[model samples]
Target: MTLIVTSSGRPCAFSEVVEKLAARRGEKLCLGEVVEAFGDRAFGPVMFFFALINMMPWPPGGTTLTGAPLLLLSMELAWGRDELWVPRWTERASVRRSTFRKLIGRFQRGLKLTERLSRPRLHFLTGSFGQGLIGIACVFLSIVLVLPVWGGNLLPAVAVGFFSLGVMQRDGLAVIAGWLLTAATVAVLFLAWRIIVASVSHGFDWIGRIA
Candidate 1:
């Protein structure tokens, strides 16, 4: 499989690769045909791409909407004049396979709306809806990232990005993990927000008395 980065510099639709992996849904990407097709050495880069996209900020109006800048950033990081690969194991195959399956189910559910649109353009077009959501997600994440929130809002962005790539590549396992992570992140943020609000209110009351 060709893994060249797009002009925007992000790895091309991981969807295709993911799809191939999905066929082996009962097993791990490392266990069977996926390794044969993508090769054992390529696993590092593939997982790296998945994690990077998984953790990235979402595009505003769908992929095309806010994905351009992300693509550029990815390009700079992956293929810039000084580009280099940094390997990090995001998860094990056993865990990731289950996570990815769950994520794909969610993506499939959302696709119901697009399916009704009936316009091929509207359905596959990732620029508007995908990017818009991602953009909004990024802003939310930016706020959460600065706060003490665990996982932060970035998880959702990562989930969406992974979903996008996974949909394109048909990688259900990655998608599952993305969604799980996103959900966990959001939960953490909700808890943190409550804590911060309570602390701020307590602090204000303590500082107001002149006596």
Candidate 2:
């Protein structure tokens, strides 16, 4: 489980972290190991990774597994915590290495392109106060993602992923983009919930008439 630490004592790039995870292609990849791998650079990368899993076309209940971490991380960020801490149950949660590798490969190219375009700008937005705001938004989005709303997880997941990337790379532009996407996600979820409520209400009215 030993990994090479960069001169800065953390993985220099998110892709390198993925590569390290990929290298253990047949073993169980636990969240604790990932937390250890990121060391001092835990929050952004881990949040990005968890949200990325939700963004993918994975099996049902994926969010159930991923959403908890997002919630925990968001709370820490909002609280201005410098270090991440997860419960033992969460840390012990894992996925098969081969599955993780396949998932990473699926989106690696697009992520690389994003990396190329990203740069540190708008420093104020990626700073502590800004991150606290983003984290508050993430807490709401994470709850939305965990719900069983049909086809509801994608937008929030993408928004959270972008936010994580923005923080990781200190790309203020990306953080702005993430905020825009989060707004859109919230709007869509609100509309969806309204529609569901209307439908349920109509159904109950019809049942009352029948009786």
Candidate 3:
């Protein structure tokens, strides 16, 4: 991989790459441009991009659209692909430059603290085996993210984000955080499902009694 430095001559961080992409001149930013900008060996940033888009205040099915890419990416990572390759159709997918800027700006602000806290320290967890494990977990998380369950997407999205950032920066702590959050997300989803089921059963009982 090539070393990319910022204007201050320091190695570029994930956030820097995001900001650079956001600042580009265009009415719309195609997914191809984004892929080309990061190139290969930027698995974390590219996956993070897909995950982060789910946070946008989009309409119903928004998470499904954004989360689909994460599933494909996680599958590739799980299979231990050396390079990232998105679908050809994704290259044609474009978002309004104004919307892109807003999302990127929000992302920068939201992740400032995370960026400060992250650094390359845990090499072992970011190694091939460890990343493979993370990729597997991300596959499940991405599935949950795309589900229509209430409040399901948010936590899974966050967990996937942590996993991506951790793998990118070689921060085992972030991966651990992802694990914990993933567990919590699952538990919450299960509880929500049970509650819905119970409520439906009660409604059925009430209807039967009235009849």
C-alpha local distance difference test of each model: 0.41, 0.81, 0.79
What local lDDT score does residue 108 receive in model 3, on the 0 to 100 scale?
Answer: 83
Candidate 2 structure quality by residue, lDDT tens digits, 86-203: 8888898887788788888888898778778888899999999999998998898898777766577889999998889888888888889889998999788788789989999999
Model 3: which ten-residue window has the lowest total lDDT? 1-10
Candidate 3 segments whose C-alpha is farther than 4 A from its true place: 1-11, 110-113
> Every model's Cα RMSD, please?
11.6, 3.1, 3.1
Per-model TM-score, in order, reads: 0.34, 0.90, 0.87
Compute the lDDT for candidate 1. Answer: 0.41
By TM-score rank, best first, the candidates go 2, 3, 1
Model 3, CA-based lDDT? 0.79
Which runs in model 1 stand beyond 4 Å of their true positions? 4-68, 71-161, 209-211
The collision pairs in model 2 are: none
Residue pairs with clashing backbones, model 3: none
TM-score of 3: 0.87
Candidate 1: residue 83 Cα off by (Å): 24
